[model samples]
Target: MQNNKSAARQYVCKRRSDKMKITVRVKPNAKKDHIEAEREGEYIAQIKAAPAEGKANNALIKLLAAHFDIARSRIKIISGFSSRNKIIEIIYTRKQ
Candidate 1:
C-alpha cells in the first residue's frame, strides 16, 4: 500500500547536490537550439549560434543551464573552450 504522507514528505524533501560535471558535444549553427542526445557520460547539445567570437560558447552555457534547470551563473565550461567538445561544471544545483 502507498503511504500518502510518506510519499509527500519524500517528494518535498528531494536531495540536492552542490556540483556536477558534464561532457558535452556542441553543434553550432544548427537549425534550432536543443539537446540532441545523452549517453553514458556525455551529452550532445545543438544551438543556432555561430561558432565565432565566443557566441557558440555562450549559447552552450545557456543551453546547459536550461537543460539542467539551473541559473546561467551556476554553469561553467570547465574545458574545451576552443573546441566542439566541451566539459561543463554545474554548481549549486537541485536535480530530481
Candidate 2:
C-alpha cells in the first residue's frame, strides 16, 4: 500500500540520525518581542519581530540560542531571505 511504503520510508529516515535542520515561520511587524515553537510542528517557530534591516534575523539567532541553550555562533542562516519562512542550520561543536 502507499501508506505502508510512506511509513517505511519515514522509519528508515528517522533511524539515520545526523545533523538537524530546522525551519521557522517568522511573524514580521509584531508589536512585542517573543518566540514560540509550534505544538504540532517541531521545526516551526513563531517569532515576533519586524523584518527590517535584518532585525528579525538577529532576533531569531538570539532567540534560538536561548531556546536551544546554545551559543549564538552555533546558529547559522543557511538560506531564505526577503521572506517570512527561513531555514536555519544549527551547528553543534564540542567544547574545547
lDDT of 2: 0.62
**Total clashing residue pairs per candidate?**
0, 0
Model 1: lDDT equals 0.73
Candidate 1: clashing residue pairs, number: 0
Q: For model 2, where is the 10-residue window of minimal lDDT?
A: 7-16
lDDT tens readout by residue for model 1, 1-96? 122222221111112467667677788999999884454446678889999999999998888778767889998888889898787777874447
TM-score against native, each model: 0.75, 0.65
For residues 1-96, write the lDDT of model 2, one tens digit per residue. 011122221111111132456666677667655566442223334456678889888888888888778889888876777676677777666566
Candidate 2 lDDT at 82 equals 65
Model 1 ranges with Cα > 4 A deviation = 1-17, 93-96
- The candidate that wins on lDDT is 1
**What is the lDDT, from 0 to 100, of the residue 66 in candidate 1?**
83
